[model samples]
Target: METVKRVLVTPEAKKVIDQLSKQHGKLMFHQSGGCCDGSSPMCFKEGTFRIGSSDVRLGEIAGCPFYMSRSQFEYWKHTQLTVDVVKGRGASFSLEIPLGVRFVIRSRLFTEEEFARLEPIQNG
Candidate 1:
């Protein structure tokens, strides 16, 4: 069976991850659909932030687990999300704000073949 990835990290994003990991040890990501942060993906030191029951683990990017609210996941389930880094501080509390870059999500809808091979998501 083919393996379909739900989440991925661009090389630019991976470089940021490497830097973050060195400074913070381990990390994780959570997609912010709205609220104060807008739609930016927030990165945190693993275990520093709480994962609630309403969250769903989509997959990992750059070896860090990525999650989103279950409600948000419903809207994004049919798409593949790529973590990309962009210059400018987003309206997020993510660690990258201090570095003058923010992690953003770029998505592409999954083809029928890819959707069939997608990994399962875990409910938090």
Candidate 2:
């Protein structure tokens, strides 16, 4: 069966990830839904942040696992998320802060065909 990817990383984002991994080692991503971070995807060193039971594994980007809270997933499940890099410092504690570039999400709704082929997400 054909598989559709739910998360993606742009080349610019990948370059930043490469830099971050060199300094921080393995990494993971969690999409923040407002509050302190204001809906930004935060990056952390793998195993540093706890994955809760209510989180869903959306996919991986730059070899790092990406997740979202179940509540956030409900709102975004129909879309494809592309991780992109942008200038300026974000308010979150994500690793990219020191590099003057912040990771951002660009999303678009999946087509009916793509949705049908999308891989299932796992509950954390």
Q: Taking the tens digit of each residue's C-alpha lDDT, what string does model 1 give over 1-124?
A: 8689899999999999999999999999999989998888899999988999999999898889999999999999999999999999887779899999999889999999999999999987
Best model per lDDT: 2
lDDT (Cα, tens digit) per residue for candidate 2, span 1-124 = 8799999999999999999999999999999889987888899999988999999999899999999999989999999999998999998899999899899999999999999999889987
lDDT of 2 at 45: 99
TM-score of model 1 (CA atoms): 0.96
Alpha-carbon TM-score of each model against the true structure: 0.96, 0.97
Identify the leading candidate in terms of TM-score. Answer: 2
Regions more than 4 Å wrong, model 1: none
Name the regions of candidate 2 deviating beyond 4 angstroms.
none
Model 2 lDDT vs. the true structure?
0.94
Cα misplacement distance, residue 28 of candidate 2 (Å): 0.2
